[model samples]
Target: MPHRTIELHVDRDSVAMGDDVVSHAGVLSAPRGTLLSAALELASPEIRSPGWSWVAVVDGATTAVWSVDHGVQLLVADRKLTRGPVDVFFRYFVQIDPAWLFDRLAHGVRADRRALEEEYAPIAREKYRAELRRRERELDGRFLSTECVDTLQHFGAEITLHADVACDFTHDGDAWSVRRADTMFQVFRGGGGPIASIRPHALGEAWLVGMLGASARTAAGRADLPDAEPLPGLELTASGGRWMSRGATVVQVRSELAARVAQLAYGRSVADLRALLDA
Candidate 1:
């Protein structure tokens, strides 16, 4: 039950371009901060504990490491990595249909674009119009003839962009701060000495999803479907070890680390680390 880290190591002679990287899924639970701390603690070949269970997909050419943890996967290109623990937890997940199916739609390109077209299209359009009008009002009738064109141009530049962030996790801390520095949201009591920092997966909050699947019985008992009550706090009180989420989005923190320990058992590397670490 060890965390499975699907690693993709690049070869020295491998080409830099093209599909030089591969991906696989594994499981691990080392809050973002702890991961960073461990990475910093290591020298080139210090046989340290694998930090947290990791399924790493490494680009052999660039040595970029992409790790999956808590269902969130991250891409560490350019040899740079997350210096701090991510303080966000997933709010929820909604998997929409893939875009390729729309290409085969009989209705034409419009139909093809309709899958995630509604994702943020309406909001974008409205925001565009509002910005145009605001710009026009600011002109104070000085450019009446060119108002429409100016407004449109202004709108184009001012429009906001959004990504399909299904797992909406939040942290009280500043996003910019965490993204740029080495910071931990929680203290590490793992007894392995001071941790380096925690690192979260870049993917959506798959950690929680896996947890929900693992503890379906307890979660189901907590509520009914369609109206299932959200966990009020980030502190999950189930298995044993207490966990604090990066924010409210991580509504359910593990009450125990027993299940997490079991997950790492499935990974050969993690199993080896666990035995050697004697945790």
Candidate 2:
């Protein structure tokens, strides 16, 4: 069946501070051809600016646009959208008395948490817990460097930080021989570390440091990283795949799933047919 896709352009400045996924103006409908442009031209003059932009694709053709006052603040209303289409449009005035934005962001963050937990909780409990524990131990003892924290704080856009899991490990001079539930992760110390690591169960992580060049620019644009640097160790892995080692203290990441995560983290797909040169 064909249906419409509705999306909104949101900016932090538009909503009262400390809100999640709230914006001053938004649009709905399909994203096709010049539908966005035409809709913008028909938008109210007060809500028009270049600070934020988004596209929605509906069915196979129809499209729409939403523009808003770049300077005004809009409270994020905590209203869950319906199933099929994100059918809701709100516009807030300049001066308001109540804390509407605060309520909205709180509700939105809670909703997001519920959605994510529903989806990932089972995976962690059934197939991912042991491996995930191993990875976290690696993250804390050996991999948790000032640089790693800086990188994650700057680029690692983790929406929710799960409860910390503990494990045992021994620092082996150069690397840490950490022991997880049923696995061992040899976390490297000093300068060079694992940019991305995956397990046999399609779980992985990647670190982008002083690499990633233009790809870094794209990642930063998506708020995944803080700065644009060289894209190093584009780690790729998959579930039920044999572990592929790169010789120097491989972190045992699967291949397929790693590629997908890299795309989200790097803002580009594996089949980047854009005549790319370096990371």
Candidate 3:
């Protein structure tokens, strides 16, 4: 459904070049390059059936995902495209300008977009690919300009986290071995002692809550993104709630998710991470 131009045949056994999606809506090939794919999905109600099977032959590498007849509908992978409110097509997935290829196929080609691309050079009987790659400078310039952006300086730091936490745990049912938190070494003005300990697990849990709050906030602002579950911690104006943590790690994780959301919402110009639940 993502690609309207490329014809999708419901035949799985057939091998064809440029047949983007094969039978059962499986991806067959990429648009002439290494198998740097954005995402892939192969599903079936009869997936476990002995006959239910398929393969992807991207750049001559044979690969199969689902061969079991089990009812399942899932997002098969999580690349940048999965985090997006953006299309999973060539624009973000394949990193290609969606309209540039047909720029020259405008001189009255009596067919659909696919026909314009396929018959572009061959049907006219010329060298291979006569109308591809015309505007290299313009395309590359824009892409490059967007890439080297420290654009949202404050946002960048919050999206990624660097943490150092250590604790001790024992195998369950051991009964003899006990779980333990790392020693919180203290050197007071008067003396020094190990006053208490820190639970690495609690720290991690709080950090994750903060991360989700940030991810949810940005995801909410974008019109293209689907509605996500509510984050109670996200509601607190300042400082974390009972679950969320108030620290650099939480901020960093939120920033990472926000930045990705920004990228996905690029064309629409949604310039924020904090807003209404239905922004």
Candidate 4:
């Protein structure tokens, strides 16, 4: 059975404020008449409030089928495309209306309450409850921040490819792997604070190695951090592998925190890493 491989590319790694469209190009390599499906996931650092949507355009035709799942927006397209190139454009727009603010605010308050109940312990619950109440009171007059609005505007896209044939398709790359790689690199690159610890399963060790390798390459360019010794500590044992921090405060490495760590470790710049991945 033959397998298929798809390579994804973005026209610009980063865009300015006025830029409305970002071009995406993908090359699909498969046998002739092979049917395949492609989906693009667009995600932002912050959650969108309301009256905002993302649009996808292909061959000058705007896509009508789009959906959001767990804060990540997706656009899917299927075709009986042979080995060829694919192109698309993504646009994001938002409209704010004061009349709709109250409804959004009510939803946000409910969400906060649910999060507090699910995430906090009984002993610490009241403190957060009070804080939420205070925030609710403040929200009565407060407006959204420019920084918040700007963050909602910025987003990243990941392309996923799937084949319709009953053939074996294997790819080591995924959005989660990319995200983990970026996180691990940041912990090793070091600037603000290193990760408290990382507990990787047996299979996760390979990903950890790749991320460490990228961090090693990045560290070579820095004069201050000459070695990888001062970064987080990694130990491999029969049970699994662990990356530990030297500080008293222990911060578990998660996706969101990893993104923040990358930002800090890379001096608030991720364009180089993104370009490398895109290439």
How does model 2 score by TM-score? 0.22
Model 1 residue runs over 4 Å out of place are 1-204, 219-254, 257-279
For model 3, the superposed segments whose C-alpha errors exceed 4 Å read 1-11, 14-39, 42-51, 68-279
Window of ten residues with lowest summed lDDT in model 3: 169-178
Model 4: lDDT of residue 115: 42
Residue 172 in model 4: lDDT: 31
Report the lDDT tens digits of candidate 2 across residue range 1-279: 533443533221344355445544455443333233443333333434443322222222213223342222222322222233332233332222113322333344332324434544455444444655556545644433344334433433231222133222222222222122233332223335442443311122231221222234454464323333334654433446633444332445334433433343343322231113123
lDDT of candidate 1 over 1-279, digit per residue (tens): 533322211112111245236421222334333443233222111112222212222322111121121222333322233332222211111122222222222223222224444654565556655655565446443211133222222222121211121111111221111111132221112233321122232111122222222333244453211222223322323433444335423222333432242232222232232222221
**lDDT tens readout by residue for model 3, 106-204:** 233232434434544354323211222223322332211121122222123221211122111111211111112233211111123221211233332
Greater-lDDT candidate between 3 and 4: 4
Relative to the true structure, how large is the alpha-carbon lDDT of every model?
0.26, 0.33, 0.26, 0.31
Predicted candidate 4 versus true structure: per-residue lDDT over 43-100, tens digit per residue: 1212244443334444444432222322322233455544334444444422222223
Q: lDDT at 86 for candidate 3?
A: 21
After TM-score superposition, what is the CA distance of residue 56 in candidate 4 from its true location, in Å?
1.3
lDDT comparing candidate 2 with the true structure: 0.33
TM-score of 3: 0.14
In candidate 4, position 269 carries an lDDT of 18
- Give the C-alpha miss distance for residue 68 in model 4, angstroms: 5.7
